[model samples]
Target: MSAGGAHLKDEGTRRQVVLAGGAAGLISRFCVAPLDVVKIRLQLQVHSLSDPPSHGSAAGPVYKGTWSTMRAIVRQEGITGLWKGNIPAEMMYVCYGAIQFTAYRSTTEALAQLDPHRLPPSAESFISGAVGGGMATGATYPLDLLRTRFAAQGTERIYRSLGGSILEIARHEGVPGFFRGCSAAITQIVPYMGLFFATYESLRPITTQWEQLPFGTSDAAAGVVASVLAKTGVFPLDLVRKRLQVQGPTRTRYVHRNIPEYRGVLDTIGTILRTQGPRGLYRGLTVSLFKAAPASAVTMWTYEHVLRLVQEMELAAEA
Candidate 1:
């Protein structure tokens, strides 16, 4: 590997990596949309998971657990309910994947030139992943906010369609509305992605040697481990980001009524701690872990194989 970077030396190869990353994102999003929807529902709830607001009966929380939530969504909102915000979600994933991989590849290549010997592989991976994740999060933040809004709404439709949601935000919250939780998102994603890639790269060699893993390939297993670990570490920030994004007039439309208004990041965290306790910050973490495992597996598997395929095609074209 020269200072210029290994496989990404050429424009053609870099383009291939970007496309592969996009495909990986698309596939992963489709596979885990239901878990994501459930996760958001649980995150937005004001009450504890174990207890529900007494509505004059022994009814449990609207979303109790992963399986129960899935059942509830299916029963009330039909099968498609699980896919509430999939349209914007998919768009965000594709763009995010493309931007993230390319930025990561570029950043690593640059680091190779600047301080290849000085920086450890872990540090390089962390820096590159943080750059990539930050770029992706910034570029696709609006879509992310829209996806959250769509997912937050229940049987009572809030912003109806994607275009309508955009218009509603524009009408009320203005252009800045699209970037509502972007700071929190970037803060959460930067370190999370850094840790994710650092962990993945660190574990990949060991995981690959294990022949009995579920995917028969080490990357999938490594991805699962990395994602679960990384997600757990940054989950509270993620929950906060979701809460911030759902602020404004749209909050009234969501099923989780009576959500306390947050002034900013610290205030939100403080409010959660004061009102709901530390456990409240981890709301929906169970479903998030479930979503993270398969999403990471699919993402790593797809990105690797697709990149290989594209490289092979490029070589064949040259040959």
Candidate 2:
């Protein structure tokens, strides 16, 4: 390849794949932001609707299941309430997904050059995904905090805008507050992403060869399966992460505490187990699954399609 050809090849490098992945993540997230809002609220409720109302319940706790939550949000705050934090939430997830794919692709490409024979394709996929998710979590954690806070905002409207919320968090908890639950996030997301890529990649041949479908179709099918598996496995850690990040003086269940609300990750885990049992850790599992299944399919398909198109264009230009 000539110098110009090499440069053109760089256009389709893993770094640029981040752009395609980000676009895919953004559109997929927008498709399911409302479901995400419901999932976050449900996770933050502090009490289980499955059990009878108790002291820790969110006031009357009228919002119970996913359907009831959507209905209550619509009834109390209008249809728009269901999508209150759509912008920030989409932005956060988009960046997260983009960074994830970028790191995954980059890591795999780099590793293949070093020790291609030692690690199988499935193992490579898992490692790349794990690294990608951890890096993305660390890089975009503050945005995660803001997005969660935005989604958690309900009828009381404690947080009027994104800037106001950031200022308040900075004032109260300082810069570190932005990364409160980062450890939990990384812990959960690392393995979650690892299994996701492993499963998806492993299924590729099954869908493409056995089913004789197109590449995008195979990946979408695989993505749905990966999504369900990853979400279900790490849901408890996700609940803990949300609880740690969302502490504040609000009318909701996450009312601010004068002191450090949760001692640490384990303490938070134990508290939930004691208070709400296993069910507590899975507060919004239903809504999350509902959102994840389609979101994963769409995101995978879109990413595959977009990346292929971009690479094709790059190749054509080089030609």
Per-residue accuracy of model 1 over 44-136 as CA lDDT, tens digit each: 888776786444222445667789888988998899999999999999999999999999988887777764354777888899999999999
- Would you list the C-alpha lDDT of every candidate in the order shown? 0.88, 0.77
lDDT of 2: 0.77
The reply for model 1, stretches above 4 Å from the true place, is: 1-12, 53-60, 115-117, 214-216
Q: List candidate 2 segments past 4 Å from native.
A: 1-11, 51-60, 210-216, 249-260, 317-319
Number of backbone collisions per candidate? 0, 1
Provide the lowest-lDDT 10-residue window in model 1: 3-12
